[model samples]
Target: MPLLQRWRQAISKMSSASPSRFAVLVFTSIIFLWSLLLTLPISSADGTPTRYLDALFTAVSTICVTGLSTVDMSTHWSPFGNVVIFLGIEVGAIGVLTLASILGSVVTRKLGLRQRLIAASDGNALRLHRGAVSESQAVRLGEIGGMLATVALSLIIIETIIALFILPVFWASDLVTHWWDAVSYSFYYSASAFTNTGFAPNPGGVPEFADNGWFLGCLAAATFLGSLGFPVLFSLVRWARDRSKRPGVHVKLTLAATLVLFVLGALTLWLLESGNSDTFGSRTPIEGLLGGSFLSVMARSGGFSTIDIDAMNDSSLLVLDALMFVGGGSASTAGGIKVTTLAVLFLAAVAEARGSSDLQLFRRRIPHDVLRLAIAVALWGAMVVGVSSILVMSLSGAGMREAIFDTISAFATVGLSTGLTESTTPAAQLVLAVTMWLGRVGTVTMAAAVASSERKQLYRLPEERIIVG
Candidate 1:
């Protein structure tokens, strides 16, 4: 074909494809390219090249911000390799949020009905019914830039502050020989924890400062903020700037869900692991409580843990699984079905049980369509975790519970593990890699439904009564 014909064909194809599909391709290409670079000998420790599958696993996990790794960061990779991984993660995080915002912003943009609906619903910011928006809504590309700048600058500032707060602790611990190295590690961990990427450069995950209340607390603060989603951040920033009256329903719900889950997970972990030999074992009350709280936030998609997750009691692991599966707030760095989704589901169920005609929340009527979307996202996520669990067990010879735990870690992109990730078979690792991608890109909003066409409800069929359960 002629060059003009080829350019026209490319433009036509992109015009027809959904933004989500294009985003997936872009992210996938990023993962693939990063994987190859990571496999280079210069990227590995001891000057030996990394294997294809393991390198691929690391690339996908890092880019997806899921910390499940086939190799230890400190021992397996050189400093060069670490830099590569860091850059990959930064890009991946930006890509995920930026693409999500694109559906919310595109200039000269003609979008399908379904695409617009997704834009309204799948925002990092909760749209509180802005006057029946459709094609009538203005598509301003500048909206994308503003949102991206807000998210990026906020993250940088938060991470910088966190790094400063914890740098003294890191240096005092004498973990690193050089001051510069300590500074680098502090910033890296701060960024990783806040971004919820969970990659630890330390061999034992900063055990030197693990018990330091100040260091852990700083990270906890960063993780909490990062997991609240960009929408929440934007709301806070805007409120600060313009003296906004109140937060939107989405921000309100996200904050509430995040707080409730953090407390719940912390309490549960403390109860379950404070006495256990493997985790929080023989620790003082204060230490145990603090450690539990830290792990709980990590479980909520932060991915950093003070203790060996593998040694925790099965019950604690189960709780972690639930926390990881629920993940964090929508449009946030965290993954899973999202806390708001779970919250909305519970609220809907409560309303239904009370025989309410409409799902009422925060003094507003919750649309049935939004409720269905939540249900669909949750169901799709559960199905993905379920199938991946079965395959992981079959391929890796891991026990059923362990399989499920790891599967949730990958699928939610939570990155917590039971020491099974590294030992798992190649095919199982591939399953997890794919799961991480799906979870990070958003399994529900970014994959199938986003790619699907919109159907119009023009004519209604003859009404018929059907039996209900």
Candidate 2:
């Protein structure tokens, strides 16, 4: 009876806690538990023991969707470890809040207020306003789960079909010798590529076929699709299904902005690396163009690369830093400030250029709250990257560019590296880990937690202006 009373009290306390604090507590607890599970000594196929640090690193990487690895994933982990990683990616990409909501629906056959709040915060709700939808929360959660399952299953099926065609090409070129190995390799590559988790199972890392025009092209396309965010993909599908009806302005602007970024990124990389023989090295003009195009698309979000990132010229590295900073589409698998946020900021800049007070895109005015959120995300991301870079540089003695690149990779959860992660110190690794966690949960959630304790202002202050730049 005493124990039951204590349990009820605990539940009451949790129920009364601020949502942001509750979220953080839940996230931390889950991550710690997962880390502990991974830290247990696990045997690989060859009977080699996995180290605690390696396991912890891998666990953090999987949970955060950050691909920095202290050890080779393919050779180090047994099938069990691989399964753990696969599950981690699924959960991490789907998000903790969404998973909780789904689980709540399954267990209770209904969704509570807490679950609905989480769903809204996760961007699953069609309208942010309370009581905008008449359906039960359980229905909404079930729909979200169904959507996730359908998307994941579709990705696997499509990748498997694509792999069947790709395997023959790999086999013909002697890239993969055996059929089973090829199949496993193809499946792993497809999963890693789609999740933007850059962990390759290949013994030699990304195979030489990565340099092949067709292979690079296919991989780039797959990564781009994966990084474009689920919300945007669903929107596109719905719009396509109902083409007679006009698409939302957000959908139109997202697609336009995506194309613009791709083109601009490609041009920047081409011009920056045109003279560098190491990255564009000794290649025919066509090859250089192909490589540059691939880098432009892949560097922003996906971490896979045909060319050695470490070998790139300084100018090219700076270009990559910029692209990585901007990142992929909003609400997508990829991370960064997000393309939509950047688009909004760009539109805001244009509005200022036109000497207009209102920011507009696609003939639609963006809400001030949304603009503030975008700025907050950008600021937080930049600060995380900057602070992480400082910590890494201090600990590892790595060059500024290398440290910056690694920090951006961690914060964006892109997983691309210039060969610095392998040599980073323990302290530096911790910094990267924190950055990954922040990048995954994002700035808005963190900001919410910090502001939760502050009381809301019931009265408005008179408007005042400071000097502008």
Candidate 3:
């Protein structure tokens, strides 16, 4: 019970725990504390004080960068609470898992042996294989630091520029009274939309511009860019700088997958909503096309909307659900199973159809490890979304469709909602909180904590044949 004894016990426990697991635990704990602190009656607001569950939900949503909310963020929380939410968005965008690892390294002066081993196991860092290219711990850490700094600065600069362009428009339209208020609101919405954090200072989301073509287009572009993972963006940038060389496999695959999904999602929405008077009804052909295209892009990871999501036809809703579930790219600000994982799965499926022994993309064979990890991450993501949906439905008595929509939103860290979130019960809120947390950290990382204890098998087991559909 003594301070030294407590410190010793804490160190001993940490030493015994898997470093990745410890990192997740630490970050998760911090998020919970931060959420509780934000919910307390510590700031001045006009509306009712946010409940603990609501605050926690917002915190998890912000930290997970999932925008599902059980309370009206604009009405319930004060300026101080909004600031806390903004901080959470920044932290979540950078990834709490990596943040924890970085902090651990800073405190310890080096990564623990377990941490290095786990990083290697995850294939995030490369070890020398017969004198091949190898990275040192310092280089790895520097890469992470560089990536974070680049992303953080990019978000700030992009948001500032967007706010400047938007604030004047709002002022001209009389949507905002003062220059400062207009700037503040523009920055908040722009940051939220770009990060896919979905925390809006305006309750109805972007206000009168919700139906404006140019404004929606700008937001759609920003959201799309933000949702595309940092790795893909960096790779493309590098390839651009070196024009003779082709883009990396991940970047190429991400672009292809994004295009396919965007086209498919747009077509599905357009077709499904063509006859529905509520969404695409009686609109010009070009307008319909634009709306569908915007929805397709936004649904993937961005939560911005031009039309009310609640008014979409069932089929369109289902299509949006599927798109949200698939989510954005890996190593990016976006959530979900990632475009790379889905691309790998598609390639694997194609290979199976062709009776090929190896999965190939762009004439290059995919590594078995990469393929396996992709499948594992996808399966885990599906399971998390499925279970979370069930829990929400049972607790709140919301319909399956609404629950599924919210669950996908949470798991993908996309903040689009079908209006059920604000009325969700406390228990359902808690379940969603967990889903957002898991979605952000990723199921593989969480599963690794339990599976990490088992040593890697030295020998492969005999292959067994099984019947397939």
Most accurate candidate by lDDT: 1
Candidate topping TM-score: 1
TM-score of 1: 0.89
Query: For residues 1-469, could you state the per-residue lDDT of candidate 1 as single tens digits?
Result: 8886676456435534554555566577779999999999999998989999999999999888888999988789888998998887676555453543343335224443433433433452223233333321112222434455676797788888999998887788756899988888988898788878888887778565676788888878888888887767776776677774356677778889989999999888999887797678689878888898999898888888877788988899899999999998876778888998899899998998999878886787766656766787888899889988999998988998889999999988888888889888899999989888878876644433532433667998999999997
Candidates' C-alpha lDDT: 0.76, 0.68, 0.71
lDDT of 1 at 458: 91
CA deviation > 4 Å runs, candidate 2? 1-30, 40-46, 111-117, 124-154, 173-177, 447-458
Instruction: Work out the TM-score per prediction.
Output: 0.89, 0.87, 0.87
Q: What is the lDDT of candidate 1?
A: 0.76
Clashes of each: 0, 2, 2
Give per-residue CA lDDT, model 2, range 66-95, as digits (tens): 778887776777766676777676566655
Global Cα RMSD, each model: 4.0, 3.9, 4.0
Q: What are the per-residue Cα lDDT tens digits for candidate 3 across 1-469?
A: 8886676556435744655566577668868877787767753276545677777777788877878888777777777887888877877776544565555555556666443443333324222111233332212433454444556677788778777766766676665677776777878878787787766687566545756776777677777878776655655554567785456566677778988999999988988888888778768778888889988987887777767788888778899888988888665667888877788888889989999989887767776655666777888998998889989999999999889998888888888888888777788888888888888777537434434333556899999999989
In model 2, the worst 10-residue window by lDDT is 130-139
Query: In candidate 2, how many Å is residue 28 off?
Result: 4.2
For candidate 2, the lDDT comes to 0.68
Give the poorly placed runs of model 1, Cα more than 4 Å off. 1-16, 95-131, 134-143, 442-453, 464-469
Give the Cα error of residue 374 in candidate 1, in Å.
0.4
lDDT of 3: 0.71
